[model samples]
Target: MGILNQAVQLAIMVGTIRTLSWPSANESRNANPPEKAVHRQIGSDFDYLMLTRIFPTAVCRADDDSVPDSCEIPTDTPEWSIHGLWPNFKNGSYPQFCDGSPRKFDSDLIKSIEGRLLRMWPNLYPAKTAHSFWKHEWEKHGTCSQNHKNLSSELLYFRTTMAIDTEYSVGSALERAGIIPRSEPYHLEDIRDGLMKELSHGMHVQLNCLTDKKTRQILLGDVRMCIDKSFQPIDCPRSNAFQPATYFTGHSAPLPSFKECPPLVTYLLETSTEPSHMLGLGHREFAYWINPLIPFYTGFFSQQKLKHELLWGITVPFMAVAIFIYVEGGRGG
Candidate 1:
């Protein structure tokens, strides 16, 4: 919402939408994110990246109808696609924007592997948006990972992820175990148990979901499993699954809930118009929905209040009058 808000402001100022790319400031290498003392001093070294994948169209479409212009979900794209490979802290506080490397991400690096990524990590929003998903991932998570640990550079990170995704295609694993997505809802354990049999190590994974708040129907979102520094998928530590920061630390800090894969989830196939961008915002703008007043607010009610005045300062109203002599004055003689 903030990104679009800024874009709209820029559009207002420049009298044009401009190109999808963000202005010079955001494009530059990220300014150093403030350091977290505890994270740095305790010396957080993540055991692994929870390489996750999601069936965006399924979960996103179940919840939203608007697809962005930038979307291109390949017809052959099987199962779920790469969500992200998140670096998990031992205490569940993951590192982000880790060292502030000066190197800016090169978008062209992804061109050669475009087809693979589109099937795997295509943008979920702003259908016609700047191909910023790769950049966002690099800036947010990839940079946090160390070179010797696993991912070395931008290309290496993307390539390694692709390799991992290829090796353990979540959809294939599930289908091999007789678990396929359909219209019916399934229990969390059933889906988890099915994947466990197919995976080599019987990985400990979490099933993320996007639930319809009104209908209370949980839709499967992402499948996240732990991968060691060697890039092998492994059983995720329970601590990493639900970081108990609040319980262990006993601070006022709120604990992160495990809502992504709540109980009683569904695996419904989407049957709607397939637009290009991520679904949540395109069909219905997320910003307005979050306000909690959308149900009561009407377009007709708000339209009356849209007026604006052009004056920069206070204004005083006055009336003008005109007088004219009648032709009867000459006829009076």
Candidate 2:
């Protein structure tokens, strides 16, 4: 009886081992299944550029309205302040005349003008400084102040003495500097008046453009140009399915997670009216939805399903083992 019991036990052990070692049909098949549909790559470059560059520019330049006219230059000789070009000249004295001494121009006036320009065109020039030439006053007793005042007076004197036709000397200087053509009739007052009108009109237009959304498109274009110059184009994937799909099972089977795919078709249908400039933004939104967490959840659920199947497969064997133990113990007793 002892020998028979030992043989039975050995046979039971062998049977248990064989049953546990045998592979299920599903396991064998799944071990080397075909790749799943979820595998794909991500492409993002074009989308990013549109978001950061194109939209803002169009909005800024379309709204401006102010345009310049042809008047508004200072005609009478400008008064010099104590801190103006020639503070050393006797106050109200124009020495070249019987009782005339040069007066300095006001430093504060120039500074105010420069400040206005800087605010209007912040992108064009460097930030204004408190100590800029426009802000400095002529020293009352300094030789430098006297010299500056004298030089300015001399220019005014020369300009006043010259005939309107002889103003060509001014054009000669401008031509040599390559600013204007020598053949063009040079009228200092006319040029100065034109510049003032142009500046006023430009400021008005800029303000108008910034205020009106429709007109701001021009400003926005300028901004876009600047951004484009700063940014370089890079190669990126054309389609959403370029990234490889993640797998949950350690098995070589490539099963793509449907959840990981972007809803490109739905997005296209819904936002059919979206402009080409905004298409990339739309894609970015879609890509963000397909984040890494999505695949992780799919993998987790897959693992749970796999575990459930594995546990179910062993359930009958576990019950059989329990029943066999109960029977064997009863027989031994």
Candidate 3:
């Protein structure tokens, strides 16, 4: 009887997943944002937080790698570096805009670390306007953080994120584990193990695979590691990610592309010395998906004249049901 019931649920869910489609990036962006309000409670302190870092070079994107003349990137930055630090639930759903904290980013605070931010924290969408992106993140997620006291203030949020980035360079961690990028497929477990050495606190992390829905190719997007309130690593809690849309109308929920990756994937390296044609995957010049869950990120689904233009993930209400089927299908469902 239980199995029969699950089958019914799966049938409905798969149908919903099938209906999920992405509207244009402009449509999603131009969405009339919901009115803001003060958040009373989000949940007990997070099971773990993910400091997701992005690798610009690894993306099949066409953004000019050359730094603007006015700014400078470090000589030894990763192809991908810092994206943002996010508070998440073990189930994966998280709260957003927890408080009606004013949405303001301290210019002086960011200016203190401008060089690194210039190189590491890039806005993959617009050519060079990164300030807007930073502002978006703070208003949406930073203010929602439960550890605001430990975080102290807005400046503390950005500063502490940078500190985490400095301490854990996923690129450096993988290399130490003999996980070199720019080549053949590397097992997902191997990648996690490699990170284990540098990430001594716990092996609770998620590997994000950025798939080019257009190019039909996949590459690394961000590496998300789980941290506790005191900022220590903890075994990842099973993600029961919250749906922001139901609670906050007009607010799209943030979720990952895939919970786990295929058995094999290339870590990927950027070789500027070689022409893009000579290199595949990691070295191409194509745009990819916008992580909607990412604060301050407008979807990068807007296209360029690349060989493989991309679109964002189109998850409909039914899609969540479909995922439920996929996740529970084997459990007597």
Candidate 4:
């Protein structure tokens, strides 16, 4: 009887350890993202390039019209991830789907720097793999830049984006200016000034914002900066070139407006109660294995089927153990 009790306790301990020890960031790097189909279009000349960085927390929580289902919301630490590095014309028009006849988005080209890309330029929408997002960017915007020597190849384009992304990180700039992410709102001018003060060569950046439908409050979206053919920082054109183009998200509706933010803008931060990004699993799965009693996490487990599955997964094992212990005690008595 003593041996039986010891065995049960050992099994439970092993299970707990296995459940708690999820895969590390280093272990989950074998993700194979799918490729996208490219269409043929006439190529055109471009004046300068634009690099866009997205604030994930704001993107996930702000939009009420069509929120992404599986956004990779980061931890409490604020960071902006890459969207794309685009080639644009002077008149705010950009070419897309240019002729990269021999070149496709070869994942092999970026294998050496895959880890860095995953960290710096992760796809916010998890329903789609990061590869899919990269392929889309390459096929749509990157191909257009083949005319430029530095951005002619797929590897060069991605490498350039990563280098520039690190050099001009919006999160780091904001933190330096004492504008950290929080539930509280910040004045639009303070946000703009903080970003501009840190830029080099008096370079200009465009600030874009989204409106939360429920509260009708403004939230940060993308921070865009332009660069010349020499890859040096330059002020964005004074024209409406900052206006988001149609190809923004594949949605015909107009993209979020620039310089239209309210006086006060909300910059959301991840709450301690919610799951972090390194869990290597979906929110529902993490909640089920880690803590099934968190009723407050109902927002995460909104699907009825998912809730039932989680309930069964958590309750059945404990119930079986309880029954086994009761039978052994009765026999001993």
Maximum-TM-score candidate: 4
Count of backbone collisions within predicted model 3? 18
C-alpha TM-scores of all predictions: 0.59, 0.13, 0.57, 0.62
Give lDDT per model, in order: 0.54, 0.25, 0.51, 0.64
lDDT of 2 by residue, 185-277 (tens): 334333333322332221111010111122111111110000111122222112212111111111122211112211111101112121212
The weakest ten consecutive residues by lDDT in model 2 span 220-229
| Clash tally for model 2 | 42
Q: Which lDDT tens digits does candidate 4 get at residues 1-333?
A: 999999999999987775544322332222221221223243335678888888765555443334344344433323688889987765445556777733568888889888888778776554567788788888888888877777878888889899888888888888888888765799977887787787534676777787544345577877888888887878876563444522335533322333456678876554322223333233344445646544545545555447687867866886675445433322110
TM-score, structure 3 vs. true:
0.57
Error of 2 at 209 (Å): 38
Tell me model 4's lDDT, rounded to 2 decimals.
Answer: 0.64
Q: What does candidate 3's lDDT look like per residue over 32-91, in tens digits?
A: 334222232331244456677765544422222232321112345556666677665443
The candidate with the higher lDDT, 1 or 4, is 4
The list of candidate 2 runs beyond 4 A from truth reads 1-106, 109-124, 129-131, 136-333
- The local lDDT score (0 to 100) that residue 6 gets in candidate 2 is 100
Q: For model 4, where is the 10-residue window of minimal lDDT?
A: 28-37
Say which prediction, candidate 3 or candidate 4, comes out ahead on lDDT.
4
